[model samples]
Target: MWSFSTYKDKRYWILLITAIIILVLFAVFTPDYILEKTNFVPFSMLIFIVLFWSTYHLWKYFGDKKKRNNTDDSCDL
Candidate 1:
């Protein structure tokens, strides 16, 4: 199981680095697939959208949990 603390600290940076690596790899390895390919999905766009959606959910999940914990702590105090 993953811990919230680990995610809160590293999710954005990790996702960003992974996105950059994948994009660089795709650009170098698959230039033909990416150039003016309106009929098909662009590699960078696909990776970017996936990263954006994943990060949004991760942030929402952690933020909601943190808020709940804070509320609980305040009530206990």
Candidate 2:
């Protein structure tokens, strides 16, 4: 399972970004046959990671909006 703490760290982001750049460079420079027989697992994993990250940010935005609304309502009462 993925942990949010690791993702929240700046160091982790740097590492993840570095890896992604490397992967992209490798894919671009390498021959197509290098990953021709590769399984679908890595692609599935990449998609899953993207979805999870987006979902987390979306929920965070909603949660912050709700908190602000609640505070405003209470202040007006």
Candidate 3:
């Protein structure tokens, strides 16, 4: 039952697109000497993990804040 519509937030899409662009740019623009010295697989994996972790935490934090605001507004009535 998984579908693209499951993620309706524009912010989520923006983050995904930005991360992809960053990874692509990093691979293309980095100097050959630097790449030759390091294992690109591990480095790219680390970067991807960091990006996903930060994005998840940020989304959770903002989602909680939004829920709290809704509750507060309801209480005002």
lDDT of 2 by residue, 1-77 (tens): 66777567564576567657866776778676656757754884587578656755666678779989999999884
Most TM-score-accurate candidate: 3
Please give me the total number of clashing residue pairs in predicted model 3: 0
Q: Write the per-residue lDDT of candidate 1 for residues 1-77, one digit (tens) a residue.
A: 55576556566666767777977886677768556588555665876788776786678798889999999899873
Q: Which ten residues in a row have the lowest lDDT in candidate 1?
A: 1-10
Tell me the whole-model lDDT of each prediction, alpha carbons only: 0.72, 0.68, 0.79
Q: Name the 10 consecutive residues with the lowest summed lDDT in model 2.
A: 6-15
Off by over 4 Å in 3: 1-6
Q: TM-scores of the models, in the given order?
A: 0.47, 0.49, 0.64
Q: What does the lDDT read for residue 23 in candidate 2?
A: 65
Query: Quick one: ranking by TM-score, best first?
Result: 3, 2, 1
Better of 1 and 3 by lDDT: 3
Query: Candidate order by lDDT, highest to lowest?
Result: 3, 1, 2
